[model samples]
Target: MSNTAGRIEPAITDIEQLKDHPAMARLLSWKRDAITEAKFDRDELTITIDRAFIRDACNILKPEFNFLSDVTSVDWLPSEPRFQVTYHLLSHKLKERVRLRVMLPGGQPTVESIISVWPAANFFEREIHDLMGIRFIGHPNMTRILMPDDWEGHPLRKDYPVEGYR
Candidate 1:
């Protein structure tokens, strides 16, 4: 399908084809410096971008990947960048799904919200914020969705006790 620039971009069907797609090329071009690593494993293509460039990278992919299926965070405690905020996107026409990840520093634990790109991301962002304590900057309503307002710490964090931190 055609991208916003009106240029015909490759219709990516799988992770292997993604590497050659013009759309993927454009995305890599913009985040070449920000990207620390990328991998296509288990039939999913995952690209990890610096947390600071999350908004820009997501915007580039938004044109082709119209569906934001999920937004979640993985806590890698005892690590420098302790959290990984992942975006799961789908392209109906291409019948492909890919993941975008942004590694947020444990000290700050924040990243730009993609709600603007996909309004449906509002709820998913909230969930990530609530459970992982990863702030989503610019989220219309950045409040706890699955936990009480007075919750002490993010439940999903590795440091959080198994029985709940009391």
Candidate 2:
């Protein structure tokens, strides 16, 4: 798949082929099992880190991928691992970005907080918790950001009623 820049954007899934990538090389050198999957698509790299190692992965990549661009979640209700937490990181020095993801099961999804790595993650993590009900462990204030404190359910959840839960 070629993009507007005429760059060949092949969806490379093999970790071996992607090891040359700086992020991949750094992560692989730390712990191979920390990353479950790797993909290069649309000129971007996405690495799915194991839930237990998300915090460590962030710490390892912090020096180069210094900017924490965004933190968000997606709910895949019917899927066994029904939730995915995504972190977008940017490297101004290298002029590149890499996405890190962690998959969580349906009931009460939770992952360690990255606020220690990037304090900017504070609000982003709060918003995800408020709207998607995914908890960010160790977050100083995990209270609702966009939704009311008494909100019934995570409004952004796929199983959340369309008309709003009564």
Candidate 3:
């Protein structure tokens, strides 16, 4: 591969500009409505998938992103869609990585579980549920993995008390 050793490209946020990206191309071709947003920043591709189509999107991209690197969540407090669940996928054959995200409303932070696509997601999803309070529908076992069964609230949530919950 030819390399421009010193060249640094600017981030691309426009869908048109990212259409040529492998992950973006595949997802857009499969279901345009599934992708809400996309970005290629610092050599990393992040695709924001609509909550309704997250599972489908994962299934579609599974062939290309054959390895699920991680599954995690971010709490965007005071925001209407207060949570972002992110899945990091790796393609060993392509030697590439991509991130898929799903935004969930604060009132009901729920998303379809991708455990069906990648069984390794079991522990990761359970951890997110235990600490962030985001539920994974269809997860074989959704019980807390990091927190106690009787834990009062999700510890990692932005609204959770700084000190231990009383």
Candidate 4:
């Protein structure tokens, strides 16, 4: 395989200035429902979506802030409340990056798809669907992008058992 398969990722610190944008305030005002939390690294802003605000949040970020970079998710199952899906976005124009996280409860852990805002998110959303089982609403092709279609379970989930063999 060729070496250039991944998406373009800019410097993390480049987006340090994005907090000043008014959308951040508007996001915070969504009934205070948006879960804004501190990143482990201490210097980053990780906006956690409440599932309800997922699409609107992404919309405000892309066309407004120009941060249409990448979208993906993580599986934090077995942990209380379940998964933590994340979206990594960067703006070369503004030299800023912002990460959005959405915590899905154990039962129904799905969020709206962002493919309508950013076409590049199509494959990334599929990856999250394939690996974490977090369904993205409105994704044109919400099938598995990395793993096989008939795979038994989402391997990235913490509760998924690891195979003894390679």
Candidate 5:
């Protein structure tokens, strides 16, 4: 139904085949340990990881799959785990995507920094640490990026009640 190089032609399919890729297998098994639910879209895979697996998983993902993307966190109050950290990873060359997430309770929340794997994350990680109070151990420059260095508490924490919002 479309024009080709010289004559009318049909749209050819470009669905690349995916076989038994070990990275996927390992990721799936890891997800099973913590994920309550999971689903995979054609182009992206979203897996919820346990807090324990976060550091270890990112270590493997960055090097093995060349994943370089944003890492951010969200505050989910009234939820068992008070925080949700999201990692978005993509490989343009391979046209693949992986989204990894971790949940942390309010009392003591921390995750290892991935700066060693992705230099760009140095600042991003710091920002999350500063604003969300999710400690990132081993961060070369774990300083406040958005908030003042001496800020008392993490602004994004759910329990950080506003002045009038009882």
Candidate 6:
């Protein structure tokens, strides 16, 4: 978390520079088939993809992004796909980072696990599965990491009671 070493030299300082990169070209090719939306702010890129294609996207991006910084989820109660699971990735060599997002229906929201793509996703996926009730299919061990196994409902859901569960 601390960049105390010094200002890290940025790779691909201008987002525009990504246009010609092979990895970027491959990623963009899926824009219509897999990617739903893409947004860039400051120097970071956030792309929304169909949950079914997450693995393919990660594979395409693996050459440029070698690190998975974090995986988390957001619950949007009234939204069509009520859960938005996000993956944060960092490229040490490229010195760049990007975010990938997938939306799932509120009813038993589920998506494939990325642990196969990045082993580090184990704990993070478990955490999201625990707190958000967003199942990660194909996860090696999908047990709850935070809440008790017997807990009634996901605590991070927008509808969860603010009061402590009795």
* Candidate number that wins on lDDT, 3 or 6: 3
What does the lDDT come to for candidate 1? 0.80
Q: Which stretches of candidate 4 lie over 4 Å from their true place?
A: 1-23, 29-32, 35-40, 164-166
| Clash number by candidate, in order | 0, 0, 0, 2, 0, 0
Residue-level lDDT of model 3, residues 65-90, one tens digit each, is 89999999999999878999999999
Scored by lDDT, the top model is: 2
The lDDT values for all models are 0.80, 0.93, 0.91, 0.69, 0.70, 0.82
lDDT of 3 at 26: 96
Query: Model 5 lDDT vs. the true structure?
Result: 0.70
- Worst lDDT run of 10 residues, candidate 4, spans 10-19
Tens digit per residue, CA lDDT, model 4, 13-51: 322344454445656555455654434234456666677
Q: What is the lDDT of residue 111 in candidate 2?
A: 95
On residues 1-166, what C-alpha lDDT tens digit does candidate 1 reach at each position?
A: 5457655443434534555654467676665676666776655678777777878887888777878899998998899778888888888878888788988888878788888788999999999989988888899899999999998888899998889955
Residue pairs with clashing backbones, model 5: none
Where does candidate 1 have its weakest 10-residue lDDT segment?
A: 7-16
Task: Please list the residue runs of candidate 2 whose C-alpha ends up more than 4 Å from where it truly belongs after superposition.
Answer: 1-10
C-alpha-based local distance difference test score of model 6:
0.82
Q: How accurate is candidate 3 locally (lDDT)?
A: 0.91
TM-score of each: 0.83, 0.92, 0.91, 0.74, 0.71, 0.83
Q: Which pairs in model 3 have colliding backbones?
A: none
Span of ten consecutive residues with least summed lDDT in model 3:
1-10
Per-residue error for 91 in candidate 6, Å, reads: 0.5
